[model samples]
Structure formats: structure tokens, C-alpha cells
Target: MSKAEKTKQFIIEKTASLFNTKGYLSTTLSDIAQATHLTKGSIYGNFANKDELAIEVYKYNSGLLSKSMSRSFGDEFPTTMDKLHAFVDFYRKNWRSVFSNGGCPLMNAATESDDIFPGLKNQVKKSFEDWAGKISSVIIQGQKNGDLNEKANAEEYASIFIMLLEGGILLSKTTGDEKFLNLALERITKMIDNELNILPS
Candidate 1:
């Protein structure tokens, strides 16, 4: 990539954590500039405003989750149960590493941007929709393969899964309890394994 493009990516990467940790309203252009070690003029040259930078940061963080899931899935097709398990396992394993003390960026942006920032709220909506669509697609595929019960609704299940995960992340972060996140994962994983899997008698 060109130097200018690299600089823009650098700014996004550096400031994403700030946006994730500090919230959109709390983080300032100066904070981003300071994090990226760029001058105010340099930052403005790349992004139109703090709002634009915040939107970019949300996208960058969401892209991280997307990339991680894609990387973990790899070439082999996972069983319906394994695919769902894989996602939970990834989120559980990466909760501290990827999220650190910041928590899920999508969840953070969804809660913080709603009723606060219109543009950012739209981006978060799109991100969640995209996540749901992917999960729903996997569910439908599993149903077609007879691995998952046809009675189960893919979109509904996907929405609930995403909602629970986001809520768990928020709750865990709000209460400063990582164990809440683990408990949430445990319950979700069991649901996926038991309800979604349907073991033979």
C-alpha cells in the first residue's frame, strides 16, 4: 500500500483501542493524534473529522473479529455444532487477548453510539447485521445437511446468539468480572451443543 494509505491504516489501528476503551464521545482527535504520534494536521489530512475517525475505528475493530473467525474456520468445513462452538471458543479465548480491558468493540460501539451518534450507530447496525447474516447462513447450511434441526429458525437463533454475546460482554465489562463472561460462554456453548446438536439416543 501507499504511504498515505498506510498512514490512514496506522491511525485507525492505533485509535481503535481508544475508541473501544474510551467510547466515541470520550475520545478526541488529539487522543488519536497522540496515539498515532501524528500532528493534528496529519490526522485531519487523513480523516475528515473525529466522527469519521471514530467510524473508521469501529470498522477496523469489527474487521478484526471477522478476520479472526475466518482464520479459525480455515478450509475444512466445520459441523454445525463445531462451527458454533468454534465461534464461542474463539470469543472466550480472545476475550482478554483481543478485547483486553476494552471489551468487544462492536458491543461498545453499539451501546455507546446508539442515541449519541447517528453515523456511528448506522455502522454498528450494519456490523451486527453482517454478523447475524453469517451465523444464520451457517445455521441454514447445517440444517440442509441434516446436522441441525429444521425446526430451528436460523435468523432468530443467530440474532439471539449475537445479542447474548454482546450483552455478556457488556455485563462482564460493566461489572469488572471476567467470570461473568465465562459463565455466559458456558451457557451459550451448552445451548449450541445440546439444543443445536441433538445427540442420538
Candidate 2:
């Protein structure tokens, strides 16, 4: 890659944790520079502005999540139930880190950007749609394989799964009870498994 591209990625890598932990609105260019041992000018030299950097960081974090999940659900699973379990397991592994960082990026973006940054909000919406598409595709694959019940709609299941997980995280964060989120995850995981078993077997 080019020097500019490398610098941009460096900024994103250094600041992704900051953005996830402190929040996009709360993070500053100086914070990223300090974290990366670069100057403010160096950061801006790569990013036109902090807003641009924040958007890039959001995308970067989401892409990392997708990669982890895709790896977790690889071809060896060969079934929809396996993929669904992989999804739940990934969250179980990451939810604490995500919550400590002020909860999930999508959840934070949904709450934070709604009133302040329309552009960021739009990006969050697109991100959700993109993630939902991946989830729906997996569910459809499972359905085709007769692993998931045809009566269950892929998009609906995907949306509800996300809602339950993110909403649970939000509440868990608010209440300061990590168990709240884990219990929610466990419950829904059980439900999803039960539903998965009911497929036309």
C-alpha cells in the first residue's frame, strides 16, 4: 500500500480502541496522535478531519468484527446451526470488551449520532443493513440446507437477534450488571438453538 494508506491505517488502528472506549465525539486527534506517538499535524496529514477519522475507525472496527465472525463460522461447520452458534459465541467473547468501551459501536452510534451527526447516523444505518445482509444470507443458507425452519424469516430473525443482543448490552451497561447481558445472551442462545432444532428434520 501507499504511504498515505499506511498512515491512514495506523491512525485507525491506534484510535479504534479509543473511539470504541471513549466514543467518537469524545476522542480527539491529539488523543490518537498521543496514542500513536505522532503529532496532530501527522494525524491530520492522513485524515482530512477528525470526523473523517471517526468514520474510518467505525468501519475498521466493524470490519474486524466481521472477519472474526466469518473465521469462526468457516466451512467446517457446514450447517446453519453451527453458524448461528458461532455468531452467539463471538458475541459472548467480545461483549465484555465492547461494553467496557461504552458498549457496541453500532449501539453507541445509534444513540450518539441520532441528534448530533446526521452523517454518522447514516453510516451507522448502512452498517446495520450491511451486517443484517450477511446474517440473513447465513440464515437463508441454513434454510436451504433444511437446518433452519422455512417458516422463520431470515431478515426478521437477523433483526431480532441484533436487537436482542444490542439492546441487552445497552441495558447491561446502564445497570452496571455484566450478568444482565450474559443472561440475555444465554437465554436467546437457548431459544435460537431450540428454534434451529425445529427445522424440518
Candidate 3:
């Protein structure tokens, strides 16, 4: 890789957590400079402005999260039900790591960018759409395999699942109680077993 590209990536990696924790508006170029050990001129040399840098940082943070999840839901989880369970397990097991890293990047960006940064907000919206698409795809596969009920609405279930999980994250983070997330996971498990799981004839 080119030196310039490496430098840019270094800046993104350094500032990603800062942006996730302090947020876009609150995180300044000075803070980024301090975090990256780069001069303001260097930062600007890579990014056109703070807005551009923030957008890239959001992508970097989100990409890391997606990669972690993908790693958790590996090829060993062949069945859709297995994959879904793994998804829950991933969050449950990694909650502490996530909390220490400043919470879910997608959630942080969505909540912080809305009504403020239109570009960033739209990016968050696209991120949600992409996430829902993945979940819905899994639901459709489950139905095809008779692992999940054909009567279930894939999109609707996906939306509910995301809402419950994200809401649980928010509540758990706010209250410093993992029980809130566990409760949400319990509900999801019931939903999968009772609502989506296909019954034997």
C-alpha cells in the first residue's frame, strides 16, 4: 500500500473509537489530531474536511462490527436457526467488549447523526437497510429449508429483531444492567421457537 493510504487508514483507525464515543459534533479535529498524533494539516490532507473524516470513521467502525459478527456467524452455523442463535450469542458474549469500545457504532451514529448531519444520517439509514437485508435473507432461507414457518414475514421479523436487539443495547448501556439485554434475547429466542420455528407434522 502507498504511504498516503497507510497514513489515511491509521487516522481512521485511531479516530474511529473517538468518534463512536464522543460523537461527530463533540469530536473535534484537535481531538482527532491528538488521537492520531497527526497534525491538522495532515488530517486535512487526507480528508477534505471534518465531515469527510467522520464519514470515513463511521464506515471504519461499522465495518469492524460487521466483520466481528461475520466471524461469530461462521460457516459452521449451517442452519438458519443455528445462525440466529449464534447472532444472539455473539452480542451476549461480547457485550462487555462492545460497552468498553463505546457501544454499537451503528446505534451511536444513528442516534447522534439524526437531525444534525444529513449525510451521516443517510449513511446510518443505509446501514440499517443492509443489516435488515441480511437478517431477512436468513429468514427466507430458513423458511425454504422448513426450519422456520413459511407464514412468517421475513422483513417484518427482521425489523422486530433489530429493534428489540438495539433497544436492549440502549437500555442495558443506560442502566448498566445486562439483564435488560438478556431479557430482549430471551424474547427473541421465544420468537424463534414459537413464532418462526416450523413444527413437525
Q: Which candidate is the best by lDDT?
A: 3
Worst 10 residues of 3 by lDDT: 66-75
| List of clashing residue pairs for candidate 3 | none
lDDT of each: 0.82, 0.80, 0.89
What are the runs in model 3 whose C-alpha is more than 4 Å off? none
lDDT agreement of model 2 with the native: 0.80
Q: Select the stronger candidate by TM-score from 2 and 3.
A: 3
The predictions' CA RMSDs to the true structure, in order, are: 1.7, 2.0, 1.1
Q: Candidate 3's residue-wise lDDT over 1-201, tens digit each? A: 899999999999998889998988799999999999889999999999999999999989888888888664577998888998888888889999898888989999999989889989998998889888888888898899878999999999989989999999999999999998899999998898889988677
Please report how far candidate 3 places residue 107 from its true position, in Å: 1.1
Judge candidate 1 at residue 128 and give its lDDT: 83
Alpha carbon lDDT of residue 24, candidate 1?
85
- Say which prediction, candidate 1 or candidate 2, comes out ahead on TM-score: 1
